[model samples]
Target: MAMDRLFAPPAERWQAVSPRLCSLRRALLTFWLGLLGLGGAIVAGVVGMWWLGAVIIVVAAAVYAFGWWLIGRNWRSWGYAERGDDLLVTHGVLFRTLVVVPYGRMQFVDVTAGPAERKFGIAKVQLHTATPATDAEIPGLTPDEAESLRDRLAALGEARAAGL
Candidate 1:
């Protein structure tokens, strides 16, 4: 009956990821492409195609700008709620997806951070299950938060499995 409340995060539910994720994503993209742009410019200049090099740089900048636009929206799209029996993960902007992983179904939980993610002090939490199709992941949380979530999930998994 109340459609307005349907879209909202459930009461005391849905822990949001770090807002800095957008900047972290954009920075990672820029760092990777910026290096390529620099190399391309150098190579084109060596091959006597100064114009091509300039065009490459311009295109790189434009692409980065477009991708940066999506980073914010994509960052905002992620949410996770720990229900009594399962974890609900929702993400995506143009392509929405929802994953439900039962606590008893989780085989393990992994917390990871790549170079860029470590630099940004963010980590991703991956949930492993016997059924790969039921696995889920939650990204863009601080290292501490990620570890806490991992511990909680593992405990919940063990408790749920013991009951089963």
Candidate 2:
């Protein structure tokens, strides 16, 4: 199968989602989760389950460290490029995955931001195609950027589909 390197020639113009994603992901995946885990451990200890509390504390620490690193790695791995006729979305650190969504194949586009994401002032854009398997998503964009991208992609898809 043909695939393009994330920053290779054709896709060299790849646009990153948002550099803030690493911090946002860290807050969501690690910070709050770590707090919860530690709280649970503390509660366990208060209930006379010292062994359980110790185990929980150890597990929480491990998860916090690993998740903190993973969040940054995952954030760095996401990138997208708009080629002439297709949108290239590539991600993953260990098992690299690249998705090329032809403009003509896009049925619709959606921009969304959850409560947590809104709090962080970031949003995501999702591209839908006739084939579910080929749909792609790009996250960690600012609200305005997400809306602009959604509109542009939708227009491009319509124009390209008309030609097909």
Candidate 3:
């Protein structure tokens, strides 16, 4: 079978994550690169190795540019779809991941937003199941969207569990 056929696309279109997620990722990347540059500068000053510092700076710049491009693709790769009895979450740039979480199997759901995520007005929804390995998460949703999804998933999970 062809690789594309291994994971066929769902009937419904995927709901993409918020674009603000790219901004959040960019901010994080910039912060980390800034720290690396600072550390390199300190080391160079202490060791009197200005050339080493320049090399580090050049490498950091290259990484930052690559990361910036990758971040957008990564953001675009993330998507979720609410099906009849399950939720589908898909993401990844190189290694694709497709998670199918049945409502009945959901033990609990959580909505979380870190300081940086909140700064970008986005949150993540995590679904826990009987086993940790099958758990699925969808990130980069607006606060309101995350709350509604959490509530809806909770209700569906309860209804399905009651049937079993």
Q: Among these predicted structures, which one has the highest TM-score?
A: 3
lDDT of each: 0.88, 0.86, 0.91
Collision count for each candidate, in order: 0, 0, 0
Per-residue error for 148 in candidate 3, Å, reads 1.1
Badly placed stretches (over 4 Å) of model 1 are 1-12
Q: Quick one: RMSD of model 3?
A: 1.6
| Local accuracy of candidate 3 as per-residue lDDT tens digits, 15-41 | 888999999999999999989987997
Ranking by TM-score: 3, 2, 1
> Candidate 2: lDDT of 87?
91
How do all models score by TM-score?
0.87, 0.87, 0.93
lDDT of 1 by residue, 11-124 (tens): 646788998687798888888989999999999999999999999999999988888888988998899988888888888878777788999999999998888888888999
| Model 2 Cα lDDT, one tens digit per residue, 1-164 | 34534435372566887876777888777768777888998899899998998898888888889988888888888988888888988888888888899999999998888887888889999999999999999999988889888998999999999987
TM-score of 3: 0.93
Better of 2 and 3 by TM-score: 3
- Candidate 2 accuracy as TM-score: 0.87
